[model samples]
Target: MRKWLFWLILPLMVGCQLGAPDQNAPLPILGEFEVVNGDTIYHTIRDFSFINQDSQEVNNQTFAGKAYVVDFFFISCPTICPKVKKQMLRLYERFKDEDKLVLLSHTIDTEHDTIPRLKKFATDLGVGLPQWQFVTGVKDSIYGIANDYFSIAQEDPNAPGGFDHSGRLILVDPQRRVRAFCDGTDPKSVDQFMEDVERLLGEMK
Candidate 1:
């Protein structure tokens, strides 16, 4: 009787695990992680470079071995930028001490947001590089790289900032793969994102 009961309970426990989501599972590799409706093919963030607020050149190498949150915004955006940035600051405060985390804000108004302008904007925000970097580049390069992250940024004659962009904070893993994202314009969503961030970092550990 005891042996029969043990066998029955063992199968039940094994089934539970086989059907359960792995709590420590790394985030899904974004930007084309599959093919043929099943074939696996993970994608990664492509290489690119831009000038940060301090006029330093930044590239994909800057994120080597680190997971960072990225977003697109024009310093002068009159709509979602402010709300998104507010959430970004909250993220910064929460993860600032985590050495593996960083924040990258790319300016979509490339024509007007020069290195100097980016510098001033960083000053206005009361933050600076390494932990948080504000980057600017040629209009086309910035616009193109934004899409590589599965986000959008492009000029629109009718848009508020002269550019239409997504207000999303993208989470990239140490491998350069986009792992997660959240609505930057929503605080509650960011709170949930903060939880995801913790989970992703745990995978790294």
Candidate 2:
């Protein structure tokens, strides 16, 4: 009877071990990303180059090996740009120490936001070295990257000084794939945004 009991217990323990998750395997990169009809949205960003606030050439691979948040804004904008920049400032304060996370802000008004202008904006916003990048480039290049990578809306009207865009932050993974997005104007969305970031980073570790 003791032998039969031991055999039964042995099988139960083996079954439990088999059902557990593998500790050595990496976790899935996406746990909260929205899937449409069981298909993940794989994005291909357009290749481009721009000058950052520090006058460094930033390109497609600038975000490699890290998860960075991106947004588009012009320093002269009187409306949502200030609010968005302030909110992004808060975000930078939270993750500034984490070398794996960074922030990139591209200017939509390339004609005016030159390297010096971008540098001044960064200084006014208190952006630190290697932590934040304010980028500007040819008018069409900046606009193209905004639409392609972030899926944000942007239209340049023929009217003088006329342009429209959406206020949204894009989260991109180390592989240049868009992972998540959030409305920059909404404070609640920032909370949810960080939650997803944590989830994604945890998977990579």
Candidate 3:
């Protein structure tokens, strides 16, 4: 769980297909993370579980052994969720066939966004199995996972939409390490996310 430990384990856990990027690549430099300050690479997202649309249990290992993009948003969110989800949908469309790239959207407002609600949301978005997961669970569990692992999600009473937060898309590698973080709202940011995914996947080769 420590930084150095994660760095030490990264190479062993990552598949041989992922090699470091070449000199001319456009992806963000991977080893320059210390310069980014708060953006960290995690070994695991602990103590969290949520039911998928099929009523099956899903846990941290759900994202193990691949490059995954994650976000926290409730379906009823009036402002950022809609825009954030649009980017997520774009991400899903971009890599739906790239079996190693996965997507997870978590609902911050658990009381309103139940498992059934998540099912409906994913259904409306036309997301099929084995590509994306729309998740909701206990309020504290959801909030804790967001705050501790992804460093996004907050609660506010007077903010524009009753909650104050950022539109962040988190990138995690096969070993559950945070590789890159992007602003989910901007087109270029999403493009950068895609480029990063490619870089990680390229490293796999």
Better of 1 and 2 by TM-score: 1
Candidate 1 wrongly placed segments (more than 4 Å): 1-23, 34-39
lDDT of 1 by residue, 1-205 (tens): 2334634564353234234335677555555554557876676778889999998989988988999999999988999999998999899888888889999999988878888998988788877778899998888988988876767899998988688999988899988887777778978778767877888899888
User: Can you write out model 3's per-residue Cα lDDT over 1-205, one digit (the tens) per residue?
Assistant: 4456645754443322134435355333333234236775424445568877667777777766777788887776778778888888998888999988888777777677777788888999999677888777777777777754445676788866667666888777776566666778877767766777777887766
Error of 1 at 72 (Å): 0.3
User: Which segments of model 3 are wrong by more than 4 Å?
Assistant: 1-44
Candidate 2 residue 132 C-alpha distance from true site, Å: 0.6
What RMSD value applies to candidate 1?
A: 11.0
What C-alpha RMSD separates each model from the true structure? 11.0, 14.2, 7.7
Clashes of 2: 0
Q: Could you estimate the TM-score for every candidate?
A: 0.84, 0.75, 0.77
Q: After TM-score superposition, what is the CA distance of residue 124 in candidate 1 from its true location, in Å?
A: 1.4
Q: After superposition, how far is residue 182 of candidate 3 from its true place, in Å?
A: 0.8
lDDT (0-100) at residue 150 of candidate 3? 45
Model 3: residue 93 alpha-carbon error in angstroms:
0.8
In model 2, the clashing pairs are none
Residue 191 in model 2: shift from native, Å? 1.1
